[model samples]
Target: IAKIYTDKDASLDALKGKKIAVLGYGNQGRAWALNLRDSGLDVTVGLERQGKSWEKATKDGFTPVKTDEAVRNAEVIIFLVPDMIQRTIWLEKVKPNMKKGADLVFAHGFNIHFRMIEPPADSDVYMVAPKGPGDTVRDYYVAGGGVPVLVAAYQNVSGKAMEKALAVAKGIGATRSGALESSFKEETETDLVGEQTILVGGIMELMRASFETLVEMGYQPEVAYFETINEVKMIVDIIHSKGLSGMLRAVSDTAKYGGMTVGKKVINEDVRKRIREAAERVRDGQFASEWVEEYNRGMPTVVNGLKEVDNSLEQKVANELRDLIERGKPKK
Candidate 1:
């Protein structure tokens, strides 16, 4: 079994007294900076421009510095910028100014695993990927709980990479939940596969297909939205807190029987084959290459896809329903 760590398995000693720089001040960066500071660690926020993120850092009590300057002064640097921009920033700003033996950290293994941002051999390279969004991570930490995280070491020049990784995880309160030991490749490939097969792509497509089917069957769009979209959250919440069988037990007998008997037929061998194909694309680097190429060409496909979704009948119905629901809510 893979190693699992809790608060008892980690300590902040490895990170104590070290100057840590958090680049980006965006989603993951802001959370990491705040959590580390609350944990009594020195954290410096780095930004490429004096924009909204820079202002946010200042409002949060950080004297944000330029990316290169932060790299020059830190013993540890965490790259939390978007994946598409990391390679450019590393080559131009971080790589030139980073301390020779400074530790490099990441929230995801994408850049490293795909060889988009290769760190120097003299530095320790590791990852501490929280298993949820940054806001969720921070909220859970504040509630005296934590989101679980995966910790991995890509390189161990310092011979203590894993120790430092665990310390970083602890500082961010991830050890309060659990820290699962992993490798860069395992974390990267699995994350990609899950996102494509279940989390983002699969779920969106499933919802769209269900909504279309209900509409095609002559159901009222409002009723279809409630059944196919709105109630998904309720079911998902139950499944998240309990097991699949628990969810089945909680629902009506009709639901349980129909779901068990018909769900498999809907998601059968053909669907499984498509999911496997998606996983293969991720593992074989085809998806990465396509994504990078799309990014380089200014993300036309992504932009157009979003526009298509925005103009869809389903989206229009969703917006109207959401507004109606909001208007009905009692004022605070």
Candidate 2:
């Protein structure tokens, strides 16, 4: 069984009296900064001054400061910036200013696990990754609950990095739900594999293929949209709240029978091979290196691909369906 920690298993004492700096004000950064503050921790948002994030953070009641300044003053520094830019930021900004004996944290293990951002030997390194989107993280916290989190330690100069990581998890309300202990290697590898498979690439391809197949078979565009895309959320909600078996049981007998019999046929050995290849690329750092290079080159491939998809017939159908749904919503 997985070793899970709840609120009862964690304490905020480890993080007490430490000044925390949340670098970057993007999705995870904003949510974590607010949640930590609400949990009674002294939190400061660190970002580039005069940027939109600085203004937004200030409006949210935080005195946003420069990244280096924040690092200099903070005892616990959370690197919540984009993974692609972390090496540059850490080498030029954070590493030079961070105080000795402080703790360095991350919401993802990508940079650390890949050796992109190596901290000093004196500082502790750990991660507290909420296993959900930033909006859900904040929403659950506001509802007096929390999304699950994965905590891991890479270095433990103080011999209490795990305790501090768990405390950070608790402060963000993750312990209200549950937290599982993990390692940087495990988290990074699994996260990348999932993203490249079921979560992102597989889901997108499946939905698009389903929609195209329906449309090619003379189904109406709106009907195809409803069948292939719109109902995914409902199915996913069932699977998420209960489980796959629950979802199968909840659906019609026809659906249950059809899905069980044909699912493997659709995603058989060939598909599994491709998924393993993708995972291998991620595990070997090929994907990470290529992605960083693409990012550094202004994401030309990504932008062009997105442009093509934006112009696709499926996107057109999706846009119309979205507008129709919006127009039909009851007035507030």
Q: What is candidate 1's local distance difference test score?
A: 0.93
Q: State in Å the error of residue 25, model 2.
A: 0.8
Candidate 2 is scored at a TM of 0.97
RMSD to native, candidate 2: 1.6
**Candidate 1 residues 15-117, lDDT tens each?**
9999999999888888889999999999999899999999999999999999999999899999999989999999999999998899999999999999998
Residue runs of model 1 more than 4 Å from their true location after superposition: 323-332
My TM-score estimates for the predictions, one after another, are 0.97, 0.97
Error of 1 at 286 (Å): 0.7
Model 2 misplaced stretches (Cα beyond 4 Å): 326-332
Q: How many Å off is the CA of 27 in candidate 1? A: 1.0
lDDT of 2 at 194: 95
